[model samples]
Target: MQQHKVLLLAIASVLLAMVTIQSGASIAKQLFPVIGPEGTTALRVGFSALMLWLVFRPWRHLPKGRNWRAVIVYGLCLGGMNLLFYLAIARIPLGIGVALEFTGPLAVALFSSRRRLDLLWVALALGGILLLLPDMRSVDALDPIGVLFALAAGACWAGYILFGQRAGNLASGGTTVALGMTVAACFLVPIGVFNAGSALLSFEVIPLAIAVAALSSALPYSLEMVALKNLSAQSFSVLMSLEPAIAALAGFILLSELLTFTQWLAILLVMAASLGSTLSTQKKPAAAS
Candidate 1:
């Protein structure tokens, strides 16, 4: 009874987090025309760090010794992931960009698996990527540069996962994230300032930036932490597999972006691969037990 309710709540929290994050990305995209992607990344990451710091007060539990290195690297990965993702979405459809960036985590999951079943998931992911590749014969081919940027962002996401684990072990989840966001802001905010200059300080930009920060980072992170407390990691990863589809819907509703049949199929394949990887990984432990 109580456990069932908790599971339901965790599932809902993860779903809501996906929706909120995608909606935030859509809103962040709106800022690009006004401040450019560089400026938007600055405002989003910088304001996110501020909001996280206020809530977590990570300064009260600072990382000690070698842990600082882990947090720093985690922060760098977070910043690079955001920056590259923004650059990717600026050129490509938001859904496709998200799907591409998702490959990073997918690869991380698949590569770490020693089971033969994992090979099928890897193949599915590769097929999806192949479908997404720029084909000169196709009129609707995606921008190769944008695809590369998204792939790069996915790589950063993988790094974020690797380093974040180490950092998380050193402190509470909130503290690690808060500290990491601060570090991200330290470096990323300057690039935005250099690109957008005084315009970043405009009354109009600040409010929207705050909204972006809250929707994209603060609120979603808090909700995910709630979900994490209740859900097993395998279950969490399975639920997260839905992110690309949610991103597609958000992109369509907010940005009026549409996907072709092929693109939609690609997204589905990637989601399937992600789901398969999670399920297979769970099976391994169960069989051993």
Candidate 2:
């Protein structure tokens, strides 16, 4: 029953993060024209850090040792991940960009996998990406740049998974996240200032920026940390494959971006593949490594 409870908690937490992120993607579009992709990334991270500091008071927690190093890595990964993701979304349809970004976690799954079924999942996912791309209907002129950024985000996300595991094992999950967010914020300021040229500092944009920070960075990261505590990495990975579908839906509703029927079917196939692979290894990870 304890295991069941934990599983439930993890699912709820992850779904909440997904919903928040979907909203965040739209908010980002609003800011992208104002600050450009990199600048918007900086703003989101900057204000998210500020909000976390006020809420969590990391200075008071002051964890020491290996956790600190893990925190540092977590911070870098966190900042870099969102920056790249937003940069991707700015240029491409959210669906395709998200599909490409799926590569990172897919790599992680394959690396840890030995099952024959996992191979099938990878193929399905690839086929899905191809369907989404095919002359890159879902992408814009800058979409390739977005793809590259999404890959960067995926890399960062993978790193976040790796280092975050260490951090979660070592300290209070919430405290670790709070501190990591603060560090990410510190790193983003100079980049944001460079790109946005003080325009981001305006009082008028404060409320909007704050809302973005809250919905996108602060709330999602905190909940994810909780979810990690109750969920295995593999379980979380399986759940995450649904993100493209979520993003597609959100893009359609929020941004009015639409895809062809074939593309939607492709997404379903990938999702099925992911679900199959995950379920096959439900009680156990693929275990190749």
User: Which predicted model would earn the best TM-score?
Assistant: 1
Candidate 2 structure quality by residue, lDDT tens digits, 151-172: 7887888888788888767666
- Model 1, residue 234: distance off in Å is 1.8
lDDT of 1 by residue, 1-289 (tens): 9999999999999999999999999999999988999999999998899889899998899977877999999999999999999999999999999999999999898889788888899999998998998897877889999999999999999999999999999999999999998899999999999999999999988899989999999999999999999999999999999999999999999999999999999999999999999898888888998
User: Which candidate leads the pack in lDDT?
Assistant: 1
Model 1 pairs whose backbones collide? none
Give the runs in model 1 whose Cα sits over 4 Å from its true position: none
Q: Count the backbone clashes (under 3 Å) in each candidate.
A: 0, 1
Give me the overall lDDT of model 2: 0.77
